[model samples]
Target: MAELARIQPSLWFDSDAREAMEYYVSVFPNSHIGSITEYPADSDEKHLSGMAGKILNGQFTLNGVDFVCIDGGPYFTFTEAISFVVLAKDQAELDDYWAKLSHVPEAEQCGWCKDRFGLSWQIIPENMGDLTRTPEQLQVVLGQKKIVIAELEAAGAGI
Candidate 1:
């Protein structure tokens, strides 16, 4: 099998590649927008009118993880199948991420939320694996939208 270049995730946007990159960089620590490629005004691409001077591609780093966003227009959209998991160190971190990342209230489930750009994310606790060592603990995790560390601990302890 061919090797992957660190498996950077690329997000497709209708015309908000730069916006998405900036938003992500603002939300995550140690993140930055690397480079941006704009579509040429004279390009013969199919969607010339909307593509001209738009961000064709944008490179960004979120919490040190590299990602890309493409302003490919409305041909494609994001789904829940693929998502980024923010492993928070504590409830405070999780709450911060949850506030910044959660935009679609209906999409909030089991610590997963869809942002304004329709991208799904899992803002989970770092100690989740250690706590969810049993079926009950796992159920506790599945029962809520935001993962509360205290609740997980309580459930794990059969409290």
Candidate 2:
């Protein structure tokens, strides 16, 4: 028997669950699509909703973290309050994610940006949590879109 993840984040989409899942898998390596269920055309909810044969629910993994996406109609949308934080191992990794993921320039601040799918993401350096010990170091990163590791280190040392 296969073990299941205890908790997984389910993303609600209007009608693009499959597309989003595929896109995510393509972006992150070592990820693949899991189970997928589609709405039946003859179901009672089909005619009124017009979502027949669309993805009812689907699962995928990003960097080993499981996630689910549902074609749940447009009653709700993604918010910035909930975001995925990508821990970049180096400046190259940080730059790659920032360029590939961020789509809304106006929404970017303090290493946070909204992707084309409206999902919020924080592209942060892997050592950031350790570097921001002092209030001064924290302040240095408050207004920057992409974190500069050298600057953060200097700030932490009061240089």
lDDT scores in order: 0.88, 0.87
State the lDDT of candidate 2 residue by residue for 104-133, as single tens digits: 999898889998889999999998888788
> Which candidate should be chosen as best, given TM-score against the real structure?
1
Q: How accurate is candidate 1 locally (lDDT)?
A: 0.88
Name the regions of candidate 2 deviating beyond 4 angstroms. Answer: 1-5, 42-48
Q: Give the TM-score of candidate 2.
A: 0.88
Q: What are the RMSDs of all candidates, in order?
A: 2.3, 2.9
Q: Count clashing pairs, candidate 1.
A: 0
Model 1: pairs clashing at backbone N, Cα or C within 3 Å: none
Please write out the lDDT profile of model 1 over residues 6-90, one tens digit for every residue.
Answer: 7888889998888888898999889999999898875566557758777888899998898888888789999999998989999
Question: What's the CA error at residue 11 for candidate 1, in Å?
Answer: 1.0
